[model samples]
Target chain A: MSKISRRKFLAGSVAGGAAVMMTPAKKALAAGSFEGFPDGMGVLVDFTRCVGCRTCEAACNKEQNLPAPAKPFDDYSVFDEIHHGQPRRPTSKAYTVVNRYETKEEGPVFRKIQCNHCNEPACLTSCFVNAYTKTPEGAVIYNSKVCVGCRNCMIACPFHIPGYTYESVINPVIKKCIFCYDTRLKEGRPPACVESCPQQVMTFGKRAELMNIAHERMRKNPEKYVDHIYGEKEVGGTGWFYISGVPFEELGFDTHLPKEPIINNVKDFLAVVPMVLAIWPALFTGFHLLATKGKSHGHGDDHSHGEEGH
Target chain B: MKKLATYGIKPHDAEVKADGQKWSLMEKLLLGLTLDQYLDQLKRNKFNWLLALIFAIGIPVIIYRFIFGLGVVTHASYDYPWGLFLGFGLFCMVPLSASGFMLGTTVEIFGRHDFEPIERLALLNGLLGYFFAVVYLLVDLGQPWRLIYPMFVSWGPAAVLFLVGWHVATYLSVQVMEVSTAFFEWIGFPRGYEFIRKGTVGLTVSGIILSTLHQGALGALFTYAPGKVHPLWYSSSFQWIHYFTSSIPAGLCMVISVSTIVILTMKWRCDDRFINNLDRITLSLAKGAAMGLITYLFIKLLAVAHDNEWAYIATGWGAWWLFEMLAGVLLPMFLLAVGIHNKNVLLCRIGAFVTVFGILLNRLNTALITFNWQLYQEIPHMWEIVISITIFAIYVATYRFILNRLPILYQYKAQAVEEGVAVEAEQKAAVNA
Candidate 1:
């Protein structure tokens, strides 16, 4: 039964090897420092500008057609709800959430959490079914149909985004902010959350232009901001850049994330794969011939050879 | 079986009975015993009752998980996507099953026939461990039906899991072929056994290839979560190597542990050849385990030094890491060394058990316990724990079932293999007369 399968595998491996050899290592290395696709749109979130009102969250739920909130969006008590010591995070039902982080002097700083939509997304690279896609329009979207629900993306996501719909028995898939990819971002419109914000806390524009605007704001009134864009160079730069009044670490961001993309960390091991596939068969076969040179072969012969030598 | 042996009734180990009558398939399946006697022995065995109790609770919970979904049974949310199912099952079981290739290399590749008596056992261990690991993976996967997506429907060849998926699928087939030789012998299928024998070298070589890549690929999967896995356990440069190297001893020690259990619990099934040569083979396997452990220790230290993580040693996690190394690695290595020096089989067995536990600890530490160190830890749900125990019980029971009937611990004699030819010759002479 397996003889045919392995025969197929042997052919498959050769083709796979050729494919690996054909793909230039330079392209892989280029991805190491890849910031984002040129002309991709991005959101610049200014943490200094927002009131604690969750209009964005309410708009996101309606735009995504998600389930109604347990408490109405106006209920601020949800901010105090902590599960597993973590403040409110995005779930399948709620695509975005606003968390209240208390600062030393500035009272409660309201931080809206959702998918950062990274340029070189860990989720995209970690997926074994090619379920995730980093669109040219700067959105990281996922296909539910092909999703095997391995959850490697959840583990790989540096920002702790992308919740699973574990309640669904038959068709559970990853649920995360897609930057309103199908509905708004594709047509060059701002997401519902961005447009719904009464405080104009977020600016939707070209990623390069947003970077310039962010730096200008920090340069002009340096004391008003923390002088750092949290997503600018984190995990190879997320499309959702953030300029905060407080330090990023204070806002519960993983500040120590590597500047290089997460896939770069895995590249070393990936490089070894082809080498082993190519080398091990001959190497061990050579050992077989050498070890059993004058002795009885492993097959069809036993005790007579057993006591003679190791 | 022990009670049956007292009556001088031998179990099935040949194709034909002593009277040259062909043994029926039913007789072979029942280990040459009547159904009543077979059922009686099973009743007398205390272990079967425990297995029965586990399966009673576990099977329903497993079915319930499918109906209610993974969330009801497991604490697998966004933070901890893999709980005990993968933490203990996939990570721990794969390494412990490494014996297939380890012994395959020793006897088949290197022609160290001295280890031949235990080679089939090692191969079977590999086959079952991997088969059950996939079982655990099936339970853990949210959409287990789409498991073939990585192979047939979709392609994400760049992902570490993609490599893992392909290698495991391929390696499992290879192990099935390797272990089928024993099955063929038990059922009196010479053509199939001979066909498998011709490809033994090819299969063993492929086994080594698949084993190396997949074992390393499992570690490589963690590289995708560099920030999640604790610094003590994470090494981008050496993580795969660490997993591969450590699996060497893990596999070797597992064989030792399994053999020890076999001797203690079901010595009636083991043939004279296996019963006598087991001590020497255990010592030989222990040497290999020792070599692997020392190499693993060196590389583990090198990984920490390579990453320049010595400073983390002073912290709480660092202390815990040190404790793992001392208790699991250093202590076990010392015990094995002392056992070998004294030629003490019992000490070696104790050391092998400790080594097995150490590998379990290492895999669990890498995949679960220390994973998401920065986040709050989540214990597996009650039903999840029950299901995990139940699946393991099934593995143990299946393992015993195969060992009890198959020619794994003992050789099926040659007379049965040549019985057909001998009968044909006699029948021709009688016709002429």
Candidate 2:
């Protein structure tokens, strides 16, 4: 019992490290507003250029080595599929899907459903095992080896990007788009989805350059594109943003999302945590002193007598 | 067990027998009954049949979940990632189990010894509730084997779940220690019992810290999904407080509910000390619960007001929320108030039961029902429901098994019996003189 086991020693060090890293005050003070890495890459998507060709989805499936879809990617009938009163979303089997939303002005707007790879990702922040990481190249990648399968990342993702392979009994894990980090982004090449677009709907470049390009395009044709660029300032900005000709809300975007990071919403509670941890013991121990002062010390004495207490 | 009482037999509640013989571990586990007698009693209890029925249907499905995967047994929807397994099991079970720290604070820290009769029961309730919550988690976790990843393999200290995992694990240990006094007494481990008693204050205080953090942390987990949870059910700043405060009433009421069931079904097992004090302790517990309810209610409304979500009150979800508040919170609060004022135990019991239901409703509403309100509603698959019921039944059985043997509902009479023998020996010596 006196021996400190290896696991315990490692646990203590990890806990110590976590405590140092997780101090909410330190974080709040250290980081004011982190938009994105200066040189990090991103994609600019123009909804006007997208023709709902579904080529990007096919490219993604092939690149990620995902299982064959129930319907072939070329089938336009897949656009009509809806589940739970919503349009088709990316699933474990498919990392990216194109959902078609009909607009009053524009007959149909194809929205690519994939990981936004936020500058500050909610999934990355919400993960307890540090399973998700935001690489310098602006890819939100997941390490499945350490994933406990709590699925908190799924709950935290505002974009609803990650999917769980629930069918796998032995090694179910989160299956989501990694922005082709391993094969493309690491090599400084555009992702398959972006490169495979025949209409060149997506322009891959540095995040700053893309933001400027999106604004320039919006400025060049103010009448054609919506004034707002989706994901530019939404949920702390994202690696992939859209300049939709139609309103983002009409195109199935949650426009009402807070501009600040999702973790900001949690900071208030986290700030209180250390306070509770620091103050509760002394306050409660003082309470014990104030409560039991000059009274029966051990509970065993008065308990048998059935004394009334408040 | 009640049938056994009719035969002039008593369940084990002492270390030594009336004939001065010590009980074997197996005899102690069987409540001092012969194997045949224990088997007969078990066969006679109708509740065992129901438990058998649940285990029959649910255990196989649980094994099937392990073999085939969670996709087969659950909705397995990515949008509704946590269904009944966590919604009912982890979120709901944790708050109700707050009784351990609540009662520990009351009897140990606050010097309220009068509540001691029910303290062990609350501790046991807390321990088993958490134990089974973990069981549910293990079943729900994608890789239950790697649960320790957060502790040793990797760390996301800033995440709300990290705090939850740490605090729950630490507090579970604290509760096991708190509840172990009864076990040590039952098992005749005086040193262990004494050791635990000496550290009661430290254990109780640590329990408060862990309970306060993790209980709040559970709510904070939802704050990570600010857009997903319905605004009526979600308050960023007040979310943790709502969870932590509501847990007090939930915990108190759960203890009250469990004790009520114990008093009704296992009256013979309860010693005179427990039986006599049960009503007063129940009322006392109800008073705490009522106070907790009012605080919880006030904070819940305050959160809505703070968030300026009055317009949501007119919607259907709002109506459902109103129903939850009125039926679960306000009604139970009113009942407990009336019951406490008039010293009505039955009404208090009813209020406690309703409060437990209310906690369940609120957690399920937050974690499953109203969550992803912008998305389609998710109804848990049939097998998921069965698994939840089966796990709860196992919890009940474990609770009963402990209460039947571990001197939780009843005091250990061994010490008094030894004193009785001492007096008898003194009388014999006096006569001889």
Candidate 3:
């Protein structure tokens, strides 16, 4: 064959291979349009009703069998403490913590931050080792066995909930609230924090139903609460929804977050992966042949002759 | 070297030894110095002692990290997810190691045979840098043994990490293949070297493909955190491009830096061809890096423009961004231009070093310093610093070892090369005719 024909043939084959590799991903994307599991469970937090009593904190601690906090949950002094100039969210030590936002207009609106258990959770999607799993019941749980601790999920998280036990010498798992999935939520029971709330601030139900209930409460009490449900459309809709009299941003929510899932940001790159894999062998092989066509195969052979010695 | 008196230490010198006696492996390994002289040279370099000190202190800490877990070594804050290991090792080191593919393309594939003298050094530098980056990653991982879990255990096909994991693994192999030819030359294995050479086009093409994907994949890893990585530093659509493009200069500048350092420190080990061509190669490499930096600068702005991030430029992060641009991108670019214009290799050398520092600062900023701009800044633990420096010391040591022995700095003339050339022609003829 002429050099041109060979080059054309290789390039054509590579293009064909790339097309083959990309077809499935494109098909999957066209078919999968983020229709979340319809019956997924969710939590609705009425921030207006929360008094920062720390009842939910104590309940989460008790249910998870976590180490006791330095101060008692009843000691209200913990609420005033701030680290890194921001209110506390979930940590390895604290699975769920309700931070009190002292708003000028709304008095005190307590916003609870934990794993939003996003419908399309970044944590679940970013884990390379399958460390995290988002169950149908709407809890994102993690396994420590395969956790490499690269912490890309920590970077990916919009709410910044997953905490690593850097203090542990061995088996430092990512610690976060599993929404009581293992012990309670899976059995159709409310999470420990929700069940333990004194003011009934948390309402647990099917995620789709809870969203409707959140909208209903907002409509019924338009004068009493903010119109927004914090997690309803944030990061592709989290299972946890928050309603407060104060604006969501004031309560330390990442209001700038896009409505699409974090994984959606990576789709453009992932779409190219298989294409490169299938096309590169032929593409570069063709380049090699074309570049070296008229030149002596002497240098090329000399090159590999050198490689084998290693 | 005593064996290379007139040849100098550059790669361009085609001078045959006056007596036509090839230096044996042992003499080359000893830099043509006898055993005692080699030992005396080792004792003379105080930097070796410093490296010893760092490993003495840091190696134990690494062991401690493995035994006790990452928590003992790093602050392990929930907010600051990745600390020194990832911030410096994986993120920074990978880009610097882009030298392999960059040089490989220049010397081998594109027929820029002028770069052949310094090509092996660049390839060795890349291979060692990447190998050690993985070393640091192993220390930082919670389950270091299960590092291959992404490949075999359970795959998260859709994850950005899936891309990073697969690409890094594959790219590491491609680099190994690219570097192996030098090893084969050193070891006198003609067949192995010839086999790999036959696959050169395939390997080089694979190198480009792998380098492009993983370099971009590293940036794509950040896309998973749109809200966390500052808007000025992060562009969802353009982050991959910024990283991939900057890496071109970053990798090229790294070759210039490594070559410069090798010439200055290990001149004795380098053959005449490498030593004589060092200055010209440095200037040429700097020119390439300058173009890369200019492209990088334009793309960074384009990324900002694409995102309409004009508002971020006025903030403190913007100032930080400008500083990165001024020092990292623009200053080296100007210096490189001047260096290339005046044919001043020293200025090009300086430009290369500056560009290297700039790449380091950029990676550190993206991975550690400016990550979670809204969150508090984290100072890496003392142990973390110790381990990071120690690993870097090991990288330098390995690089030196390879440069000393491999045909990277000095080509080997062996019996097989003549026969191998004939064999290769036959193979090509068989394939074509």
Candidate 4:
């Protein structure tokens, strides 16, 4: 190659490198528009239909092979049980629980609490070991083998669903509802809890159809239901949504959560990570050269400031 | 000839002892003291007794945490997943350890050779702080053995912790290389020292890059939970910058504080060069820290304003935030300004202490205290607190061990003075030839 061509090629390469560095790798994909897989299934819970029977809880316990609860699922007294001034949520032994919240207008309303199984799950994104996976079947499943037990997922979860087997010394792992993915959902059947709901409180179907059904129900009985579909846009939409007669906040829901996915908050930092990696080396090296120029020639007086011993 | 005592003995320029024998590596490790003198020094200190008492009670609990599980030592509440181990250890230690890169940049990158006296001490402080932070992480991790899983077994490059894990591991090596020049010189390995000296610029640049990301990334880890952390503490856009910016002051103040402790407690080990220049360096460090504090204060307020969270200031958490800012940032900034203006080394040292305390408070607030603001507060178990203190004691012991033996607080004699002259002469002769 000619000398001029070689110079042009080098210049071109440097410019190209600089251009690549200047542009962000890619703008982080925005989160709200995502509405899960086309055929992904979901459960639509109608709060007015639930009777606080705890039958779904029992079904989940049996299907997941979880240990027996402190009080039997048949005990109605368990509804009043409270610990630390808060109603009991899910534990390692229970994948789903029903909490009763009394509203002034609506009377006693029972909300079945479980993992929402978000379209873009915070637990999946925050995990360093790739332990949590959002299966195509719309279930957020976990592989305990790869879990490092950092409990970051538990912290990231907005629903506070994930629990840890912290008491197990030998092999502790995250415990959460998997939507019966292994035995039911992957086999094209509904979860055990959905199947066991005798009051027909939950309607399981394709998530898109379920959305239509929820909105239809709200439209048909505007006075009976609140004007909102909980989880439709909360934390970028969850597979399990609800239409309640009362406000979700009164039902112990964090209604103030962002409509965007949890990962949106992290994108700002993630974007800067690569820029620092690529730019800082050259930038600081240039500073070093600029700072040390002309002083490198004489290593004795210029470099050393004449401390007696040195 | 009298045998050297361990506590107050200083390394001198002389190659040979009064007995006409050269100092062996073992004797150097012993601080040129006889075995009896070293043992006597260990027994004589009351601080050692306190450390011993802590270890006696704390060590078994830490062991119990591993054998019985984290639930035994910690509250094991899933709501507050990270207790003191990470809230205090990983989050707090990483920022304080920022001294390594800060000092490295000042000396090698900025050509401020005057700050060279405490540069090695700063680097050692950084290395040990990061090293122990990882120790805390190991204790906190459920499957601590699977730590390598992030590096090799599975890759979660998109996760913020993946960045922290990678940067901290890489930076630790960079620090080892930067500080190894001292190790090589003290061990009389001229080749190793020369090789490292040639790569000083490369090492320092990489150190800056790694420290910047991981320090910021530590704060970004909380960005994953925008709802959980209080609005005052959580700003997605500014969280990383807040952490990265405050780290500058935290790093600088940590060095000043560590230097102050060294000067007060181990004056005999420091040479005239270190002792004479300490006050000036402390003042200079205070100036840098003051500037960093002002910038940090502005950005923190900027975040509050950006989030439109001024209304929260009237709440209980808002009051706590104000205390952290006033006591941790503003108070130290005022003290440092006064110290710098009046050339009061004592006041600068006090400011440094406050700044260090403030950084610790901020990290604890973000990770533990203000986390899950609506949820019930989780006070860490007594056993968890005991384990955290015990690990810190071990960190202190290791730090003292290295400072006493290595050419950190004092310069190594042979290469620093005589060989430096010889090398300069050779260079001059080559230029003239």
Candidate 5:
């Protein structure tokens, strides 16, 4: 420990000569300049364009190879499905769901809830088993093999997207929309849900391009969409952006989500780990030595007294 | 014991039989009752039937969970990701298990050997509490079989659960080693006991280290969800301290509560030394608990003040927080003080019961009630209730089993006699062989 401190001073002078190379690239890109890889695709869901057709729901079920629902996909009555008085969002069996929210002024608004695939996704960061991965192409994929089912991701996701199929005994994985990374998005095609939407509510593009298009549509007809994009800066932005005519809060969005990803707040505590690991052993050992100094070894002869009578 | 009896030895003069012989292993194992009588006694106890009923339901529910998944047993709602299992089992159980280290420090580290008679009891309490906490965690986990994945298969060393996983694993082992010393003594493994004794300082240090990290890390786990946990319950800076400090009281009070239960229901299991020393030990333990409660109270207030949550005091949630303080913290603080000052064993016991309940309420509040503060409240499913109660019953049954068989509250006389012979042989060997 003493020698390292001494060598640090010697290394300081040597560090001056190699300063430029050692510093590495301080990439001074403009804030938000990295709008992800240029070809990285995203989905823009325009609320005004959606007609609650349920075509996309059928397509998604088939595309994901999920189990068929109890009710037929053609049945729009599936929108009224409720559990514990609240409408179902998503489940291990259903990665995406469109729920009808009736407003007094606006009549009814159908909102689709799925994994937002955040730029800095909470589920990806919170997973202790490294089960989640955010690709450069904007899809957040999960590796089920490594998943321990601690459900920290479910707890961390602000959108509450990850669903554990708790009923599956043998193979339980966190089920969520992966933006069709393996099949569709990787091929530069839209997700099956986007491609199957006959109402044309869903639009697929580059995330940055999608954001611009969402804002442009809202600007052209302010009355048709809310002023804000739902996923614009939520938890440090998401691949999916929503344009809702009704307030996002009323549409079951978590309005209280911090602008920064939840992992950012946790960094403060994580930063302290190294400091503690480096300090506690030495510090406490010193305290022990100091506290026990000059005390005749107590209890060396009294191990027998630990017994009393059964 | 058989080896010791070969040389005609007895642990204590009082343990000698009328025939001038030591009790056999069978007699000790059955507590001097014949096998038939012991079985009859077990049948006579209604609690065993109740435990059997719980195991019948719970063990299967647990198996079904592993087979079906976490969704089968729990609602598995995204809003309430953690239910009764983590809330009551992991969070509540771990703090209660803090008794082992807290007492171990009092007697071993601080050199207050007066607490020796009850030390093994405290150690057993801690060991069992932690052991069962892990059992509860296994039942709650989505993929219970891959629990080792976090440790070996995949490492998210940065995550708070990472710390919890590693520390709990390490601390559980530490506690096993700590508690096993008694088993070594009981089983007449003199060399094993000596080996463990030599490493006591190192073990205690590691215990303190692991206890500090894991207790704090459990609180830090909540830090992952800043907005999810309520403001009053959420303090980024002080939350870990709040948990760690409160665990001090929780652990101490747990030992008190367990001792109280044992004295009431299993008095025959305790030897006179334990029963006689228990009241004084309870008072001493309460003193530590009071100190912990006082520290916990101040830090809790500091968290509230740091967050400037004064306005929240008028709300319903604030009232709930106050209820937690009154029952869990302030009331116990006052009761423990009064009990210690007045030397009222009953008051100390009452204080302990309150503190234990307070700890439970605090954990439950953090994990369930105030979780998703803005979201609607979640009433656990009826199935969830049955499962939680059943697992708790299993915990109680296992605790009773160990208390009945192991030299937890009582010493094993046979081991001591064997140890006496071993010491004599070792001395003779040093002189001759």
Candidate 6:
């Protein structure tokens, strides 16, 4: 073959290689179901076994070095405390809180609330500064150093998990549970909260394994536990799954949250952002050229026309 | 010599003293009035006193907020992370400022030269609105000084707010360039003005692109809270489109409203050209706004149908939504249509005001009122309200400051004459060389 034809063949091969590399990545984004790391650890909480002992809450506070709470952890009276007609939730001072729900079927049910560390965490996706990172160990952690403190993550989190230290006049940042990534989880141990549970309420292992254990528990005790495992499909699955005797909704869980990832709601707009960026310049510029085609030479007359009404 | 109204300072006329000395910058700032006349004007206006009182009460509170923390001024509920500063200041102001791109597209892209008189005003309006929106964001952000982290230090490419941050920053610069031509002329820099004028089409096109994405992105921001925002207000698929489409009318009506205010209160500042064409332009803008409202109304209904949220309209929140539609969307549409049909400038101005108010209501609803519908309602703390008003007052003051000096409402004829003289002088120098 001639030198020119050989060069053409080489160029075509390079272009084809580039095309092959690009297609699958784009397809992955379009598919949009990220199940996270295969061996990522998760916690399976059996709410039926919880005694509302507040051990997990105390353990989280101790492990996270959160500020002293208004009331001591052993004080059961704290459960009755309500603000704005809502039960106590995790605040900046406390990374986890247990709330007691008086259900019709069950006398009392306790649900421990903290960051679910979702497979596609909304807080991670919504943060503009990339402050958040979902670790391979299934811990969603945030870097306060990069946080602009926009609190957009607070707005975006489906679980309303991230809390801000608004009272700090200097250097306020988001405060939330990191699933004990720094202390225990990174070392292949369960979180302080999970380990501290007296009744072995939470079983910690690989997420896929935990899902199986949760289902197996439900299968063995069909009447004692709900047939469904919370967080298995909630917000595209979460690191923390819950099985309860009472309905999840009765315990203030947002049951209506879409099974798909929260970022799915924003994908339509994200898809259009590039399209507008790509199309609008050429589109409007073309209009400008067409509108002023022959008038370019007579641009001075355009000013005269502007002056006519004066 | 007959005293000229504030608007009567023609470009060619030397604003000089009786001694023929040029007016100093201070004298220009005083609106060409003697110290006594300026003071007299200030005292005579009760509105000025009211503004003064607001500043006195609110400015200190704003300072206190910075010193103490957001918790002092705002309720600072973690459940309600955003307050009036963002809900009202950022969201409402950005859409209202959309006038810049809309008018720029009309004149520069479509060649609607008749709209040229108001184009600078619209551009200035856009620039100031976005500028102050950032100001509000700064005040609201906990680490306001670290704002550039999103741009330079950290990159969150997947986030919608990341797109918003980059786009708003870029669009603000684009608007600055578009508005700077008038500033160049006002400052007697004909060459600078000419340079900017050459890039008008490119600037306008970029403005359109940036405005479209960011405006829609603002709505898409709410899509993250699908269960939080009321179903009537939230449609996963159409939220961005709703926000973008509604911004068209919101922006156009703002221009109409601002221009009307200019014609009424700043008549002395307006040239004969602006004065003569104000009513016609207002009507034309009203027509555009009406069309935008119609389309907005249709798409809103379509969204409800698509989401199967028709059942939501009968509840109390539904009633509130109906009121927003009727007063903000439907009523303004009807008024604008009637005003345009009959050429009633007064009616059109009223419609524009109503439309602007409606847009504000919609933004407030989406960002605050309807936000966290399942939770308790949050009324802004008194100091928060006060600070919001104070910031808005500053925005208005800045806007007026620019308008009172720049050749925004009037053409700068002196710059034109200066350009002609410079060309002749250059030609002579070339011949000599």
Instruction: Please state the error at residue A104 of candidate 6 in Å.
Output: 0.7
| Model 2 agreement with the true structure over B15-96: per-residue lDDT tens digits | 7877788888999988877777788778878999999999999999999999999999998898999999999999999999
Q: Candidate 2 falls in which docking quality class?
A: acceptable
- Give the range where candidate 3 chain A is weakest over 10 consecutive residues by summed lDDT: A301-310
> Which digits, one per residue and each the tens of the lDDT, describe model 3 over residues A1-310?
0112344434543543443343223222442447467888988988888888888889899999999998988897877889878777788889988888888887777777778888888888888777888788888888887787777788788888888777776566788999998899889898999988889888999988888888898898899887788888888998888888888878878899998888788777777766777766666555556665676421433233223321
Which portions of model 6 miss their true places by more than 4 Å? A1-31, A296-310, B1-23, B415-433
Name the top DockQ candidate: 1
If both were scored by TM-score, which would come out higher, candidate 1 or candidate 3?
Answer: 1
Docking class of 1: acceptable
Ranking by lDDT: 2, 1, 4, 6, 3, 5
**Candidates ranked, most accurate by DockQ first:** 1, 2, 3, 4, 6, 5
- Model 2 sits at an interface RMSD, in angstroms, of 6.6
For model 6 chain B, give the 10-residue run with minimal summed lDDT: B1-10
For B61-150, candidate 4 gives per-residue lDDT tens digits of 999999999989988897889999999999999999999999888987787878988999999999999999999999999889998887
Q: Any residue pairs clashing in model 5, and if so which? A: A166-B69, A166-B71, A167-B68, A168-B68, A169-B67, A169-B68
Residue by residue across B1-433, what tens digits does model 6's lDDT show?
0122322222222234434566567776665555554665566667678789989999999899999998899998998999999999999999999999999889877777788789889988899999999999998999899988977898887788887887888889888888887776555566786666655666677778778888998999999998899999998999999999999999999999999888878776787778888999999999999999999999999999998998899899999999999999999999999999999999999999999999999999999999999988999999999999999998888898788777788655422222233443443343333
Q: Give the distance in Å from residue A68's predicted Cα in candidate 4 to where it truly belongs.
A: 0.9
* Per-candidate local distance difference test: 0.85, 0.86, 0.76, 0.83, 0.75, 0.82
TM-score of chain B of 4: 0.93
Distance (Å) between predicted and true CA of B336, model 3? 1.3
Fnat measured on candidate 2 = 0.66
Calculate DockQ per candidate and list them: 0.46, 0.43, 0.42, 0.40, 0.27, 0.34
For model 1, the stretches where C-alpha displacement exceeds 4 angstroms are A1-33, A303-310, B415-433
Among incorrect, acceptable, medium and high, the docking class of model 3 is: acceptable
Candidate 6 positional error at A261, Å: 0.7
Identify the runs in model 3 with alpha carbons over 4 angstroms from their true place.
A1-31, A278-283, A297-310, B1-35, B415-433
True-vs-predicted CA distance for residue A27, candidate 3, Å: 10
Return the DockQ of model 4. 0.40
Better of 3 and 5 by lDDT: 3
> Model 2 segments beyond 4 Å from truth?
A1-32, A298-310, B415-433
- Give each model a TM-score: 0.93, 0.93, 0.89, 0.92, 0.86, 0.91
